[model samples]
Target: MPGLYLIPTPIAEPFVLPEYLKEIRCFVVENLREARRFLKWNFKDLDIDACLFLEINKNALDINEIHVFMKNAMAQNSDVGLLSDAGVPCVADPGAVVVEKAHELGFTVHPLVGPSSLLLALMASGFNGQCFAFHGYLPIPENEQIKKIKSLEEESSKRDMSQLFIETPYRNTKILQQLLATLNPATRLCVACDLGAATQEIISKKVRDWKPEKYNFHKRPAVFLIYAR
Candidate 1:
């Protein structure tokens, strides 16, 4: 392999799917110290001495530093793994930079089928799955958010782009509330939270249904979906 491997780690618990941990190398890991602790707890018996590993700590690295690290790693290895802080890699997450770099360098990449909250939410949404689109995340600014929502809804209904996206954990509720207030009330919304964990909750409800109650998505990773109005 002369490219990259976009790996998917558990969104919540490390041991959610133990098999995935043994399949590929892990890189761009958020916490090196914690990862060791986690593997020791679950895969202690397996020999992981030769696994490829890299760290991306927010406290230690700026964006450029991380980019440089990725560029260096991507040039030297073909079968290196890429991961995120949570959920699936590069879906409103990290690993995009390295994957993009790999593509530019003509490296063959493999995106393993794993715990993708986007797909899980879409499958649970009961929405028309024959055709869909995952447009990643929306940018900041209220107008931009509304515009993106409207565009996604229009595309999903008319142009057929099933809106699949997410936000930072802290801003998830705000994003949900915005969609509830700005988008059509009848729009089908699927909220997959803490996916693949004991507290995993996939709620396929209307925008209005979600507004009545306050939601706490602080400690949880969330995937949101809408199949147009």
Candidate 2:
């Protein structure tokens, strides 16, 4: 039977590809260049040119294109692989549309085990794992971002739930500073940077103890988690 495989690519160094993925020839990727690099690095023996690569536009997702892609693959009895630029597909990624289309078309969806920065950060956060919310990205504006931070902290304190969010690599320091300044002194904050890489760093401290000058997360992918009780 034809299937839709949701493959998770490595967020950083040290790539690991599953043995079964060798058989898949059709792939739906977020970025064709990055996906090609990933396949070349991990699947050294595989002929990348022979495989089919379909790039998905992150800014504008077309439902009709996805429908045709899946329908044709299913009709030809060819398994299709869905890959994100990094981490798991369909989670914090635009690949969800493809997965939804696959489900609607009755294609078997298989999710493989792989590294996820969010889950990794949560595990190392030492916060409430049972009740947590992942807010993808905070507001970009200073005042609005500060307001959002305060509200998230308030929600965490009232519900005893952990609040997780991410920021762009270049703006990591700015967000960190805002978080430190806006959150209450007693609120706990965890910053996990460059997860699953050699330069990985995980720091958990209270708002009062976070020394901005001592750390630099600039230009490095990071996850921020806050919890207040």
Candidate 3:
């Protein structure tokens, strides 16, 4: 049976795809244009014209189509690769449903090593890594969002675990402000911005110390961590 390779794409820096990517003939991508560009950027020596690209993002996911694609590829003993726009595939990203379908059809799943903003930020954070929780994204409503932040802070203090979350790049500044305003002033917050990229920045400080004057996350990708005082 052919295997389903989960290829971790680069987050911010230039492509550092593994040597094995050269062997992949088929790929499931979140964004077609970016995937093509990624291939050209990383595997400069390979023939880009010969590869197959399949789209499976939130807006355009067809299970029956994916099953057919996988089964046919498997019959040929050709491995199909799954690529995410950033970080690892299926971790707070698209591709989970496809992976689940792959499992249902009994295809071998192989995940390769790559940069993950969650783990990278956690490693840089002084919070408890042994027991932490990743709450993908916060609520949208103002009151509900603040309530969630406070709840995360309480849970962190009670369990001595860390609370992690992410915000869309455009809303980065708003979320940062919310974190500073909602969390306890003594609570330690870690803000990892543009992780794995050239302009990457990771800082851990108490909520009271996060001066608004010098911070602006307007359109930058970032991860957030919260822990007890």
On lDDT, the leading prediction is: 2
Compared with the true structure, what per-residue lDDT tens digits does model 3 show for residues 133-194? Answer: 99999999999999999899999999999999999889988888888878788999998988
Against the true structure, candidate 2 reaches a TM-score of: 0.95
Between candidates 2 and 3, the one scoring higher on lDDT is: 2
| Whole-model lDDT, model 2 | 0.90
Candidate that beats the other on TM-score, 1 or 2, i.e. the better one: 2
**Which runs of model 2 end up more than 4 angstroms from their true locations?**
none
lDDT of 1: 0.69
Q: lDDT tens digits, residues 26-91, model 2?
A: 999999998888888888888999998778955777778888878889999999999998899987
Ten-residue stretch with the least lDDT total in model 1: 15-24
The C-alpha RMSD in Å for every predicted model, in order, reads 4.3, 1.3, 1.7
Collision count for each candidate, in order: 1, 0, 0
Candidate 1, residues 174-193, lDDT tens digits: the string is 88778887778777788888
TM-score of each: 0.71, 0.95, 0.93
lDDT-superior candidate, 1 or 2 = 2
Q: Give the Cα-based TM-score of candidate 1 against the true structure.
A: 0.71
Candidate 1 colliding pairs, count = 1
